[model samples]
Target: MIRKLLLILFGMGCVALQGQLAYEGVVLDADTGTPIPFVNIGIVDRGVGTISNENGEFLLEFRPREVQQGDIVRISSLGYIPRKIPVSLLNDDVLKLIIRLQPNPVSLEEVVLTDKEYVEVEDEVGYRDLLGKGIGYWKDSVALGGELASKIRVRKGLRRLNTLFFNVLHNPSDSVRLRVNIYEPADKWGAPGKNLNESGRSILHVLRSHEILTVIDLKPYNIWVRDDFIVSLELLGVFGTENISLSLPAGNLPGVPSHRRYTSQGSWERIDDSAVGFWLQSTFYTDKPRKANKPRQLRKREKKEREISGTVFEIISSGRSEMRSRRRGATISNYTSNKSVKTDEWGRFRIKAVKGDILGVSYPGMYQVLTKVEEISFYNFQLYPVKN
Candidate 1:
């Protein structure tokens, strides 16, 4: 009689295990039958979700009382079509299934060009220098890991974007791989919205150490901006080495607002205090001219007798007195010739000018200063803070 009771208790435990609700699955490419990683899986109309691991395997658990019969599970990825299956279709016991996603086919638009000349929409006048530091995935901070985005508006229609330019600085021992994504604004809140590129379509570049300007050709992608768009650079982490950091050169300028950066692949937040590095110089051309064009003769300006060198510094106001520090990445413009160059990291700049030639010096958060090139070789200027 005791042995029979023991057998009955073991049977009850087995039945309880079978009644638990759990789902485990592997995501793969439908055509190749290969594993796919980073696929987002979630319950339909429910916030519960998880992403596939590197091995393309995922496990989701539900309480026996909370799961419904007709509930749906959805899985989606960047380049594949999303798939959904009903909970009632799964097995009551340990449900294990293999789900496959088909590749999304992207259709390209036709291009027709009737004009050879193009106009510059935005120009990167090197002005400010700010470094974006790297933070881990979870920590909420400035210039951390994830994506940084900026907005650009197109005033005219039928303009095709030809090129994009930006700058980067990285460690000499490591190489960084990054992706450039263009998106249409979701709303007027100045946030990055839906991606404009087709599924899996992106511009990837490998960056090395030192300051270098990166130029990407967007013509093959046929990306045309109608009203305005957002440009984002995604840091995919460093390759070949570990524990290395990469940063982009950012600046502050009048008429240009502070850009936005997102952390841990999450929502977009504006960088309220400073402008993030990298300039977006977009060249656009239209097939038809909006107005008639007329040729005009250009005027020639006189040459300067000497070149002057200088160091720019910013005045930081404290409680009583003020302190001055090197103004890195300031723009020194020769107003006579309309030529400009950025100051080095040490805030030192050298430009050709005469005694009477005017030098326009400007940096973000400081008032513009125009100083006449005095008969001095080494001139120094201090930029005052803007009044509140």
Candidate 2:
């Protein structure tokens, strides 16, 4: 009887010591209506805290007995000043806190380019002509108009992945990596650690300082696959740079993609003015089209003629009819009319070309070119080795 009584008393005591407590709030930029993310929030006295998710909301749980109405809460984050507010002010079990973070002042040292140092060409006419050409290749149709479109059937066999849209600055010497995060509708989705918000932030960090591309040609431009929304950092600066001139090929810029179906929301475009060039996104809308007709099986004899492969190198002005010869100990190669030729250890190669035929050179997607051959001979051609 005594044991039973003791057990009842202990249970009551435990219940009495516990109280229900919860903290909820919306975090926003004090200056703008933007929601603040990844900010750290904590109850200073109890040593408990939580970070705000992408939606700028945070929830922290505590036993009411462990926290009082008058405790102080601390909030902080990078690129922003921290603040503390009294718990008593957290009225009605829900709170709205507006925080303002000052932007970091950037200070770059002025660097001068001397006459001895070469400068690239940058004019509106040059790039405009280049991008206007039909540039890349898809499965069947050739890519055109600085935009590409293809009807993709999202069947059961297709992999499920997040759709993304991207735009870039082009230069000959740089490569940019872009990352994006998408947030699910807050009303319908709860905070998931692996959601788009974190992914976008991670990508932004990598894009801070990237290498730029110095040149471009057309052959590699056709090699871009449909899945690549990630723009290369190397080609970004080519669109426009201080004193740099961009020379586009005779046709259009290949591989700029557009939606095949009118159902898509829309895509992005590069907007340029006399002063600068930037990217703007368009709204994409699409309707479900009828199932596509199955393509007829192809005959084995009918094969694809397009072949893309090569190493990166520079073209020297030394050659009278062609680019300069490859240097010693080179590993790069160039595409010829009939077959591709690789450089020897000493960077020498004897390759064949036909008069009036086009010879394409390529390196990654950064640069490529198709040259019209006046004559086919070893004497007219040379190669440069690629270090990048």
Candidate 3:
């Protein structure tokens, strides 16, 4: 009997040692077909876990007994949909799982372009900084009860070619409006006669205006690509108009030189002469700022306007200079205070009202957005294509 017990104990030790199991695969976005790095992979019962690498690949190990063929393997991450697969059904040692994640449907306080001039083939749409940390942009003075706020920039290396997205949030009760305004810089590269040129392509004239705002939806996943519409027009041969080029247009090659030339001959006049402008501005708001402790003054003759009106949201293009730009006579409306103002060439604007009042800000070609008046000025802005 003692001998039998010793044999049984030895058998148990062998079972424990033989329980090692391994799994490998890549996790990616099912919708856009993009890879998701740092995803968490785990065995449900064994408490074993592993992380996906930069390529969204992972290798996980488990005790053979703890995770059987029919057991479940779980995979998940932020800004993505989670998934669980049956281990028994997975036949291959290497698995490629495309896990689609929906965009977070939260209010976007700000959008940041990690790389000032990002150019990459991959889709780098999600926010990269540590969650909850962001920078804000404002247009008005934060001192004199202005609605203008600060600008927000994200911290990441966004591929130069990938289109960046910004998510803005608003109270469900508040009406959040968005207008897309595109401002394209006229051919600053070319003289009335001499065309600007850096490469084979001549900056003789504006070949095609670069579109500034691609996606301008206040809601999630509701992206409207106007470029696609333009392409469809060219394809369908909608109207007889200006010159059109059919030779394959360039894919998003960030920092890659453009091939099209303004002049018939492929010659450039200047070393670094590219003339274009894409001006964008947005107007939005949060809760108003607190009033100063000083006593209030009342005007005896005229009706006094509130110190803070509504909040203003503004975002301008990155590459262009603010000096050459200006905002003129744009109107600001409120139930209590109806006013009109224009930004200087730098795309600046101002409004006045007491804190807590709702202000609606709108520009000629931009989406109109509303924000509460705050003592601390805010800047909400969007980019619009500048037409010739």
Instruction: Quote the lDDT for 127 in model 1.
Output: 25
For model 3, the superposed segments whose C-alpha errors exceed 4 Å read 1-19, 92-388
Q: Per-model C-alpha lDDT, please?
A: 0.58, 0.33, 0.34
RMSD of 1: 15.7
| Residue-level lDDT tens digits of model 3 in 232-305 | 00011101333222111112212211111121111222312111111112221112222111113213112444
Candidate 3 lowest-lDDT run of ten: 228-237
| Deviating ranges (above 4 Å) for candidate 2 | 1-18, 68-70, 93-388
Model 1, residue pairs in steric clash: 127-329, 249-277, 250-277
Q: Candidate 3: what lDDT?
A: 0.34
TM-score per candidate, chains pooled: 0.47, 0.25, 0.24
- lDDT-superior candidate, 1 or 3: 1
Q: What would the per-residue lDDT of candidate 1 be over residues 197-254, giving only the tens digit for each residue?
A: 6646556666656435555556567665666777777654455655445555665434
Where's the lowest-lDDT run of ten residues in candidate 1?
5-14
Better lDDT candidate (1, 2): 1
